[model samples]
Target: MLLTEEAMKTAIILKMLSALEYDVFDPSEVIPEFTADVGIKKGEKVDYAIRVGGRISILIECKAPNAPLDLKHASQLYRYFSVTDAKFAVLTNGYDWEFYTDLDEPNRMDRRPFLTFNLTDIDTTSASELSRFRKSVYDVGAILSTARRLKYISALKTRLKEEFDNPSDEFVAFFGRQIYDGMFTANVRQEFAPLVKRSVSEVIRDRVNARLKSALLQNTTEAPEEDIDLEEKSEIETTEDEWDGFRIAVAIAARVIDPSRVVIRDQRSYCGVLVDNNNRRPLLRMYFNSPTTRYLGLFDGEVEEKVAVKAPVDLYRYADRICATAEKYKSAT
Candidate 1:
C-alpha cells in the first residue's frame, strides 16, 4: 500500500537518504522552529534537516505521497531555508522530490525549484546529481555550482520545448521576414506559424539523424530489434511529397505530444514517424507507396487501419485519431 500521509512520507524520504548514505536527524536536533521576527510565528518545525561539517546543508519538508507538490504551499521551506547556512532546500512527498536553491539573491530562496525527481521515475543523470548530496561526498560549493548549472539548463529545455510545439508570433516572424518578400504583416505571421513549426521539426530531425549516423560507429538509425537488413537492401528513395506528408503528420500530432522526439524513418514500404526511433513505437506509417492515392496506416492496438489521404492537409482531418495513436507510444517512452 502507498503512503498518503506526511509522517509515512517522511520515513520514505529518510530511507532513501540513508540508502544514499546521508546522516539524517529528527527535527528536534535541527530545530525546525525559529524566531524570524518579533511579530511573526515561531516554534514551526520542518521534517528533517541533513547537516554537513556541523552545519545545515540540506533542509527537507515532506508531504503526503498523493499530495500535489507546489512551492506555494511550501512557504515554510522558503522561510526556514532563509537564515540557515544551507545551500539547498528540498520539498518532497516520498515519490516526488523538488530541489530548490537561492539563485536570485543571497539567503533568499528562489520561487521555483531548480530540479525535481520522482523516486520511481528518476533518470541516471538525476541519480548521479542526487549522489552529490550523500554524507561521504557532501560539498556545499560544488552542490551550489551544480544547482546553478542545472537551473539554467532546465529553464532552457522548457523554453525550447514550448517553442517547438507551438511557435510564437515572434518566433514565426523571425524566420518569416528573412525568406519572405515585401513587408512583414499580420497576414504573413499567420501564414508562417505552421510552416515555421514544420520547417523547424524537419531541420531538427535531419540534424539528429545525421548525428546518430555519426555517433553510432555508422550504425543505421533502425535499432537491431527491427531486424531490418538495410545493408543488403538499397536505401529507399523518399519523394518531396512523402517528406512533406511526414512533416504534416508530425505537425498534426505535435499539438498532442512532444514533436521534437518523434523520429522519421524512410522505409521500403512506407515513411514511418516513430517515438524515440523505435520501429515498434509507430506514430503513423505513410504509404505514399502509391503517388496518386496515398494511404496513412494508423495503429489501433494490434490492428493498423489505412486511411486514404489526398494531400498533406488531408491528414489533419484525422488529427484526433493520429494524436491518440501517438499518445500510446509517447506514454511507453
Candidate 2:
C-alpha cells in the first residue's frame, strides 16, 4: 500500500502517467519537483508538471495515502497555477483523484474540481473522460468546452445521492403536495419523509432489476428439447404485475445469492422464482391473479407460506424472510 507522498508518486502517479502515454523518464514530458517563482514566494515547488509542446499543461499536487486531498493540501498548486502556463491542476492522494480547471475564472483554478474519480473504482465513462488528458490525444479546447457540464453533472449526482438517503423538507414537501390533498403541516412533512425515501429506494431497485432482466433476455438462447416440451405443456401468461413482483423478489434475494441465479418460471396458476432455474429449488412464488389483492408465496424449507400483499412495494416488508429463504437454498448447494 502507498504510505508516503514519495511512495504515492513513484508507485501510482508515475504508472498512471505512463498509461496515458507520458514517458516518465523524459524530463521534458514529466517534470518532477518543478519549482517556479510565485508572487512574493521565491521558488515555490509543485509536485510534478506535465509538459506538452515545450510548455507546462498540467500541474499535479500529491498527498500521502492517509492525507485528505482538500484545498488546504493544494495550497502550492493554487499559488503556482496563476504564475504557470498550466491550464489544469490535479489533487490526488494515491486513490482519489480530483481534476480542477479554471472554468470560473481565467488563470485561476476553481475551488471545486471539474472532474473527480477514484483509481480503485474507475468505470468506463470515467476512463473515457480521463483519456482526454492523455499525452497522445490531449485537447485543451475540447476539455474546457465540456468541463463546466461535467462539473455540474457531478455535483447534481452527488446531491441526488444525498437526497435519496436523507431527503430534505423541501424534497419531501414537493412530492407530498402532489399526492396529498390536506394541509402541508410539519406533522405531514415528518410523516411523508420516510415514505418518500422508501419509494425512491424501491424505484431505483426496480429500474436496476429491469435492466438486468433486459440484459438477461438478450443473452438467453433457445431452450433444450426437454425444456421446450415442458414449456409447451404449460400454457403460461406472465403479467406485468407478476414480473414486477419477481423483480422485487430478485432484488431482495440479491442480498443472499447472485441475481443471475434467480430465474422466473411462469406456470398456469402462479409465477415461481427458482435458484439456477431448477424447479426443485424454489425461492418464492407470486400470485397476482386476484384483482382485489395480491399474495407472495414464501418458502420455509419444503413448506410454502402465502402472505397477502397490497403492492410490489409491500414485498419489501418481507425482505428478511425472502433473504432467509435464499440463504437456505444457497447453503443447501
Question: Per-candidate RMSD vs. true structure?
Answer: 15.2, 16.8
Global CA lDDT of candidate 1, please? 0.70
Task: Give TM-scores for every candidate, taking all chains together and pairing residue i with residue i.
Answer: 0.57, 0.66
lDDT per residue (tens digit) for residues 27-89 in model 2: 988999888755726766888999988889999988888577789856888888888899999
All models: lDDT?
A: 0.70, 0.79
Number of the top TM-score candidate: 2
Candidate 2 deviant stretches above 4 angstroms: 38-40, 221-333
Q: Per-residue lDDT tens digits of candidate 1, residues 52-154?
A: 6777777788777768898778777777777677688888876678899888998888876788666544443555577576566677788778787888777
Give candidate 1 regions above 4 Å deviation: 1-3, 6-12, 24-43, 119-125, 211-333
State the lDDT at 142 in candidate 2: 89
Q: In model 1, how many backbone clashes occur?
A: 0
Q: lDDT of candidate 2?
A: 0.79
The per-residue C-alpha lDDT of model 1 at residue 140 equals: 76
The alpha-carbon lDDT assigned to residue 261 of candidate 2 equals 76
Task: Give the CA lDDT, 0 to 100, for residue 216 in model 1.
Answer: 59
